[model samples]
Target: MMKKIILHGATNCGSSNFGDFLYGVAVYNYIKENYKDIEVGFYNPSEYFIKYIGDCKISLSKSDMLIYIPGGYFGQSHKSRFIDNAIQFVRFMPVGIKAIFKSIKIGVIGIGAGPIISPFLKYPIKMIGNKAEMISTRDNESYNALKSLGLDNILELSDLILALNIHNLSDTTDQVVDICKKCEGRKLLFVHYNHSLLARDIFARQLDTFVEENPEYQLVVGSDCLLSYDDEYYIEFSKRVKKNCIQFNYDSPFELIALLERVDAVLTCKLHVGVVATMLNKPVVCFAEHPEKTKRYYRQINQPDRCVSLYDTSEEEMLSILKDKIFEKSFVPDEEIDKAKRNFDVLNELINKK
Candidate 1:
């Protein structure tokens, strides 16, 4: 019988990253709506682990269960360095260890893992996976990665963001609402590019060409990450594209979803932007820099061709794909959303097993 569950992850509680923020929102709402009786608390490992001796320690000590929410926290990618991966593992190790010592059941849901190069890191991660009462991954690649570490009883689940009911969550900004109202007749395409990706000028030129060709369509450039650099990059990119383009200043996840719900389609390098657009039944063409997670997600939804290489794919080809996607009937199947909800089934089962 679980009494309290601490959702531990790099979630919205301490994050400005819209994707992680939405994941935290989705999981929290799910638990509150379904369980009703269980006490829910959020513990952001990235922010709180540094001050582990304070509220972090107290929260974990009192929790009956610690649930690690969805994200690509467990593996190495082009965007994340080996040192980054090591630091993340280090932050999580103490939390997991303390949870075990306190007899708090641990659950990992809809997480992604892979390409763990170091044996030293692998050993400790394996220990946590083996000790976890329930473990599930968002993709098969992640499942295989855990399987390589000899972990068993892992379930494959969809991304938790799919389970989010965007319509139910209100709080759209006046700016976004007004923009949607103004662009009633024109097709709006939500565009987000990773600022760190190489060849910004080239990508900007490609977008300019796409806009020039598609005069009926309007571009709304924005960042999924609310960092200074991302905002700066989009501001500059918006200038270079001498077409119908508006720079979106991200205020909140609710506003982001509101804009996404109104958009005709999404063209982005960020994984969650594509995921959110898909959830809204909007077509998305992903310019993947770190292609693993994005590619895996598209493939999972039976649309592998939508994920394209950011650098390698030609501008003309990208424009063609974007045009096709904009008009096509692309949507996330109802079954996929149903599958994502099952990520919580393990936790529910544990709570029921008096």
Candidate 2:
């Protein structure tokens, strides 16, 4: 019988389109490709919790390889809720519930970044060691952090961004190649615009000045770069920067990969857009809202030189930093990828035997 697998999480609900989609890509590529006898199912834990946890996922666990995802490891805490007293609430009840439910035998895979130092991570780390089959986190620091906590069945894997298949995409690659022909040697820079956010005005205004200052480069926009492509601010930016501007949103993953492969440089506010651009080895300027999480992620990958903060950055500071990083090599290697793959494979064996 084919083993049944379930991917479940509430941290990333439907509204969290990027991370949700990326996790899907990883499952599709990793387990689905390798295990033909495995049948897959996806679930939303928050939705499942509306009724129950163990019952909702019982079918998944009953199979030979039950794949629990992003489990509710961050046990109950008073700080967990917006209520006046969050920690006291979560700590006692959740801890007791977790202790009671620790015996289920199931294959587990955790796909997300780690929280710093707290019960937030501590519980996940504990459950991953106790209840899970294997845990695959987003970066090396997280992997090391979990290991320091005495975690055994864990691995430092690349972000799900690494799992997206860009190889064997000839026709879409041709489209990207055709797009590249316009400015094969010249740099193609992307600027994000949106009115829903506070910094869009500042970013767009700076971009206008930037375009006038540097006629040598072309500008572009990627999907979700703005809340809407036709938002007034973006529309004006697009109009003023028309001649060499491209606003692209390809629904197909293959086409998007091919499109991004041709870019020389990218300055992005969207999280996955920056991450995916970095994955393609395109020079990236991460104009993050806080740059807190983004910097942590970049540092985890050993690409700090390519990261910059928008927290207190002036237009001039951003422009200068953009120029400096644009020409540098920021590629994650095949060796690193191989290591992640090895860890993933070994984890499967451990889970099966257990």
Candidate 3:
């Protein structure tokens, strides 16, 4: 009989919307492509139990397995606090922390699968998933995170991109154009400063000054800045000068890929853009957002310095850097990209296991 399963990594926190958008799409795609006939469903905790899950009878109905990304089934970790972070650390700590309490039974008899992406959960939650017929994760970070939590869910080395494709936005040229018109000029460059960088206005002012002199290049705003924005922002940002620089948002990564191919270069705050640009061998600069995350990716392969950081993120400095990279010519190699693709291929096979 086809087993009923649930992949329930969802939250009611600040960025849960983004997580929902990303993982929801991934899980749905996995179901569509691989587990075609199986009965599958997804639910946030509230939907799962309909009430606070404290000794409730209806909440006991179990699924064959529960696949999750961290920070969903449980609550979020503390943002930047000592006590909160401590509680979060333990709650999300590896399964071994709880394993010491052997009196608590842990196994996958009635429960089926529970592959988790992050290192937080009840030990039985992870143990059951690990004992399931199959399990996997996309990135190495997630794998290490799980291992640290005392669960070796196996590093699938795939990317969330397995569920996201960009070409779907080709027909949305008008949307792209509407966004691009916000900033316009030959040799135009798009600069997306990371939120952690807090240098958007600083960079914007620098670009503003550079555009005043170098009529050849106009620094365009990227789509990320448009959150909860309206046309008035463009007008307001441009009111001080004759007109504002233009900006654009690619409808999808594929469209962004196509745009990157046509552009002189990209100065991005987003990591995915850096990854895609590197994969395409396009000249790009990544402003260091979270120092740790940037440092990690930077070391993954050499040439990551090709993408400059906000510390050195002056417009003049950035322009000079772009000028250099426009010619430096060292993006990621095709072999590395193909390896990632192969990892995803293997991951897909694993997820499809019966």
Residues forming the 10-long window of minimal summed lDDT in candidate 2: 48-57
Error of 1 at 18 (Å): 1.9
- Show pairs that collide, candidate 1: none
Q: TM-score rank, highest first?
A: 1, 2, 3
Model 2 bad stretches (over 4 Å): 9-12, 15-19, 44-110, 116-129, 144-152, 163-165, 169-187, 192-199, 224-233, 236-244
lDDT, candidate 3, 266-336, per-residue tens: 66655555655555555666665533344334455467556555664566776666556644444554444
lDDT against the true structure, per candidate, is: 0.74, 0.53, 0.45
Q: Estimate candidate 1's alpha-carbon lDDT, on a 0 to 1 scale.
A: 0.74
- Return model 2's CA RMSD, one decimal: 6.6
RMSD of each: 3.6, 6.6, 8.1
- Candidate 1 per-residue C-alpha lDDT over 42-67 given as tens digits, one digit per residue, 9 for 90 to 100: 76534422232224322778888878
What TM-score quantifies how close candidate 3 is to the native fold?
A: 0.61
Give the TM-scores of the predictions, in the order they appear: 0.89, 0.70, 0.61
Error of 2 at 24 (Å): 1.5
Better of 1 and 3 by lDDT: 1
lDDT of 3: 0.45
